[model samples]
Target: MKKENVVIITPCFNENTTVIAFLKQIEEVAGKLPFLFEVIVVDDCSSDQTLSMLQKFSFVSENITLTILPLRFNVGHQSAIYQGLLYAQHLDADKFIIMDSDGEDDPEAIAELVKFNDYDIVNVARGRRKESISFQISYYVYRFIFKIITGKILNFGNFCMIKKKVLETSCHTSFIHFAAHLSKQKVKSTSITFNRLKRIDGKSKMNLTSLVHHAFKSFVEYAEELLMVFLRIFILVILLFFGIIGVVLYKKLFTDEAILGWASTMTVNLFTAALVCVGFFVMGILLLNMISRRNQNKTEIFVKLAEKSELLNQN
Candidate 1:
């Protein structure tokens, strides 16, 4: 059998204090696995000592094949991950794995991820959360709202593996939201149970406000679907508005009884107003999507944030 080139991609910002230990754990775990593997770390331009530290670690590490990719500027976590995937594509990697640099995703889980060769994507489901009760509550609230709005439950995070073909298709999406993108594929991927580990170093970069922003950000990936839902609603309301108007007209023109009360009159007016309002909002959203797509040439945006490999450890 051929030895497939497996890759692990991580996006880091100010993780210098903890990334070495994280990489060490990955090295130890990877040594026990049989396939050819490489660790790809994308450093989202950080203010701390993380860049230098990764350089130093790369200089000394001999057990693992590591590549330190530093971005030209900070593009946030999702973009960083996307750039890493693009580089993996350049390297012709067979299996691409993505995880958080904060060490919340256990390195040991990599073994379980690759075992299922049949899956195009392997998503990790959080079996136990290590966050505080408040955080958990907030997460549940976000998940509940996500399901209510998009009809898809948000359970997984960045901890997942994608085959090269899946990765190619996924990069075309607006954002690298693993759960939402994989859900869009509807490919029947497999998932494994894993606990969310507490951060090994600094506090989480995302606060409640950022978390809310993150939750809503998934919509960018589902723009078409969201537009369809809104269009359906708008159409339904317009149809109902006409139906009610027809009913009211029938009562006034075709009925033999006396004119009806104000209830039917008010319903027609309110529904007409609602239909117009919905039409305006839906058109605005579609216009926004068009402008967004024009502004967002993902390949161009990510390419501008180019990566340079520092030879600080692997072969």
Candidate 2:
């Protein structure tokens, strides 16, 4: 039998209703595609019947391989996809696709992505985002911060495809944001335009605090660069702190009408002291990131096998 390799990985969390809708669209898309398609669905220990429902969903087609990897516990969205990517590395796939099970990423676009085997990776950039005004604003701010720290403008999410060459290393990254790790791969990245779709089921698992945390994780990956940015800013602030002090001293020394009193001295002292405190705080954060990078275990991120080919037969 002639088989061409392509795999899709999706991280599922309480997506009981949405996964079924997602797979049905995949089935429709798979029928028209020209290669063998295998799907790796990582269940991040959903507290609902998402896993069980997926077990039932495994019987879409006998030809298509449906593997459900249920983690030992919930480890968040990116971790689930990371586990799936680690598993996909062993599949000897020609192409690997990452998308969401909440139906925000269109399954119909899979063929469009998988067609590009020229580059190591092809990311789908959203031409139209189906997000709220608040979310859009937050995402823009997040991207702006990302640009400052990493010197890269990342406009895509996990809706992308990578060849096997990129998968071997991209899967095992310590960075929580998989896209950030992929961005650092230095391989040629191709992009296509796609419109984002709304979720089919429950609300997003990420809140504002979670979004901030997610953005922070990316910065954590580029800790050295972030430390440099901090240092540069620190230098400017210190210079400004002393510049104000110099101005105060110049007025006290060189001017006749200068208000020379204890109030002025206390104010200058207060500003310099506040700057020092802020410097220590920023230094502490960078130090923590350095320590975290040193302690991160790339290979130890756990992935427990739930069911592989059994999903097809059991359903």
Candidate 3:
């Protein structure tokens, strides 16, 4: 029987110190699997030696192939992965896997992710993160807000194996947040819980500000749904405003308690505040709608400037 082609896409910015070890780990994992594996390392125009290191690296296993995609400019992690996926579209592959180049995304989980052929996508849900307390707190908060906004629980990152069809479907949409976008897909999917590992070398690239920005990007992926949610809230607030006015009028006309000037002033002030809130909500909804439209029309700009390095092993 012919072996299936499996492509793995990993994006890195300045991971020169840990990238080699990560690639070696991937190579070791690929050697044990029966499928033919191709690893695509997308370098986000690293200012350091990341691109050089990737270009010089060699794989020992015959089953593994290394393809390095160096972008013309730094397009961030999500876009880097998108570029990798776009590049992989031309390759003949059965399954595509996306994971972080840092050691945090355990290479061993690749085995577990690929075992299920019945599913179109198999994701590695984050069980426990080994980051600092503050980072953990912030991540939990982000997840909470994501649940409140998108109405979906996000337990997975960009660590999963996807079929070619899923890849094709995803390539059409904006991959602002890979896992979040994939979660919105209607494909057959399953997830396995796994503890996140620590980095192999150097400190984490993601800081508090970056985490917040990342969370915002994920929210952007669900802009349309979030807009609808806010619209409902806006409508409810308008109804409540009218209800309050009705109650005030009834208290003045029917109730024995006299509505003083202070009471009338307070009611006007409250309604004025509500009107401001309504204005803000309307602006927010408009912004979200614009973002949703922009995302839908987003073009694959990375394809034009990305340069592909030669495959590590010809044979």
Candidate 4:
């Protein structure tokens, strides 16, 4: 039996404080796994000694490779990971594993991920979150909202293993695309519980603002999948508007003091106006989706730029 070609791709930005230790753990974990493995570290325009440190390691090790791309500006976390995954796909690896360099995701879990060979994408779900209780609660709540909006619940993050083909296809969609592409492929995907560890060296790259931005972007990016949500809301809006009017008219015709007065008229007008605004908003979103789909369907500009840049680097 041939050993599977496995590639580990990590996105590091200003991770000088933790990159060395992260690499060492990768080496240790690969030694225990029963496959031919390679490591690709993408330095996302780090201003610190992160790239320097990676270069120093790359020269000494044949199995380890490094590519540092100096972005015109910071492209955010998901785009950085997409770049690395594309690199991994170009190498023709059988499987691609993505992880963060902050040591929060345990490198040892690679063995367990590889064991789930049946799954085209294997995710390490955090069985135990190491953050504050409030943060954890908020995180799950966000996940629920995300599921409600996108029709897919993402319980994992960059710490997941995916098939090479899925990685290639998904990376082409958006600079900041999520792993939903695999799910859309109906690829065999599964999750395993893992206890998230605390960061040892540096602060988390994700701040509160960045996290919120990520959530909003995903909602917008996958809006097409949530059309049913808008449809349902639209129906409810129309029904509620008419229902209120019906109630007002019923009261005016039936009993007691005549209710068809200025207050009732104003209430009905306000409700009708609210429904009109919502209807316009939903229609606008649908129009944008139609435009976006017509534009490229799946291709993203940054991914193409990255591919071109990688080609130049090879030359």
Q: Which candidate is the best by lDDT?
A: 3
List residue ranges in candidate 3 displaced over 4 A.
Answer: 253-256, 260-273, 296-315
Q: Global lDDT of each model?
A: 0.75, 0.77, 0.82, 0.68
Report the lDDT tens digits of candidate 3 across residue range 117-229. 89998999998888889999999999999998888899899999999888887777656889888989898989998899988885787889999999988877886777677
Per-model TM-score versus the true fold: 0.83, 0.83, 0.89, 0.80
| Residue ranges of candidate 1 with Cα displaced over 4 Å | 1-3, 59-63, 148-151, 172-176, 186-188, 255-269, 272-315
Off by over 4 Å in 4: 59-73, 175-185, 250-257, 260-266, 269-273, 276-280, 283-315
Question: Which residue pairs overlap in candidate 2's backbone?
Answer: none
Q: Model 4, range 190-289, lDDT digits (tens) per residue?
A: 8887888887584665555666777765665555556556666667766766776777778878867676566567666757766765776677587667
Which of 1 and 4 is ahead in lDDT?
Answer: 1
Query: How does candidate 3 fare on TM-score?
Result: 0.89
Name the regions of candidate 2 deviating beyond 4 angstroms.
Answer: 59-63, 244-296, 299-315
What's the best-to-worst order under lDDT? 3, 2, 1, 4
TM-score head-to-head 1 vs 4, winner = 1
- Give the candidates in order of TM-score, highest first: 3, 1, 2, 4
Q: Name the lDDT of candidate 2.
A: 0.77
lDDT of 1 by residue, 1-315 (tens): 766778899989888778888888887777777777889888887778887787777523343488777776788888798888777777757688899978889888998997878888888888897777887889899888777667886789889998888887766654545567677786758788899887877466667787777876676556666666766767777777777677778877989765558647767676876777687567758766784784366663332322343322221
